[model samples]
Target: DTAVSQTPKYLVTQMGNDKSIKCEQNLGHDTMYWYKQDSKKFLKIMFSYNNKELIINETVPNRFSPKSPDKAHLNLHINSLELGDSAVYFCASSQQGSETQYFGPGTRLLVL
Candidate 1:
């Protein structure tokens, strides 16, 4: 069984559209996170949830929202997606306070 999984591994959409990606982990971790990797390969954290409580990075835009239905699941929603939002989105999970994280294969989003 996959430790971490994401649906719709590939996403292609036009600008001004809305999209969502879902993630789940079977590792029974207490914390889950969302990260974005830009075209230049720069990776950054967008949002994180610890025990279903949200902790979003200040740099993340309001257009991006992360919802965690439970400790083992996290979903990302993007509204009015822009060209700049084109990037690879990755879901990760780890034990609370742990530095090491296990990442899902990632969802590639292309906004034209």
Candidate 2:
């Protein structure tokens, strides 16, 4: 089984649209997280969920929201997508904080 997977490997949308990306992990990790890598390849943590609980990073924009259906899944919903949102969104998992995190291939979103 895939350890971690994200839907729609690539996404293209117009500005001000809404989109959602789904993620799932078969690895029974205790914690899941969302990371955004901008065009510059700078990765920043967006959110972290443990046991379906929300733990957001202060730098993340309110336009981005994360929902965890279960401990093995965490989804990201972007509202009013802007050109700035055009980047790679990665879903990752780890046993716990500051540990080695396993990352999904990534979802590339392109906003026009």
Candidate 3:
């Protein structure tokens, strides 16, 4: 069984289009996070939710938003998608305050 899962493993859209990705975890973790991996392979945390409470990373743009309907589910919404937004998005989960995190397969987005 997968500990973390993401929908639409690949996404390709024109610039200015809006998109959303869904994520779910069965690990019973209290903390879930979204990370972006750029073309250069730089990984950065975008958002995190603990117990359904949102924690936005300072470096994340306002156009990116994270929503958690429940502890096990988290979704990402990108508005006015730009070329720079194209990257591999990873969903991760861990116990609250835990250093170890399990990641999903990842969603690759391409803004044309």
Candidate 4:
């Protein structure tokens, strides 16, 4: 079984459109994170949730929002998407204090 999973593995949409990606973890982890990998393959953390509480939030635009309904799910909502938002969005989860993170198959987004 997959430890982490994301919906809509590929997304293609026009600029200014709104989209959302859903993430879930079956590893029973306490912490979950959202990461974005740009075309250059630079991966950066966008947000982190621990036990359903927002812990770490990076300097991403206000258009990007992370919502966690529980400890096992973290969903990302992007509004007014721009070309710059075209990237691979990855969802990961790990134990609260562990360094190991299980990542889901990335959601490739294309904003034209």
Query: Which is the winner by lDDT between candidate 1 and candidate 3?
Result: 3
Give the whole-model CA lDDT for all candidates, comma-separated.
0.93, 0.91, 0.94, 0.97
lDDT winner between candidates 1 and 4:
4
Tens digit per residue, CA lDDT, model 4, 33-79: 99999999999999999999999999999999899999999999999
**lDDT winner between candidates 3 and 4:** 4
Which stretches of candidate 2 lie above 4 Å from their native place?
A: none
- Name model 1 segments beyond 4 Å from true: none
Candidate 3 wrong stretches, greater than 4 Å: none
66 in model 4: Cα distance from truth in Å? 0.4
Model 3 TM-score, 2 decimals:
0.96
Error of model 4, residue 75, in angstroms: 0.1
Local error of candidate 1 at residue 76 (angstroms) = 0.2
Error of 2 at 65 (Å): 0.8
How does candidate 2 score on lDDT?
Answer: 0.91
How would you encode candidate 2's per-residue C-alpha lDDT over 4-76 as one tens digit per residue? 9999899999999999999999988979989989999998898989888986565878998899989989999
Highest TM-score against the true fold, candidate:
4
lDDT, model 3: 0.94
Instruction: Name every residue pair that clashes in candidate 4.
Output: none
Query: Which residue window of length 10 is worst by lDDT in model 3?
Result: 54-63
Q: What is the lDDT of candidate 4?
A: 0.97
Query: What C-alpha lDDT does candidate 1 achieve relative to the native structure?
Result: 0.93
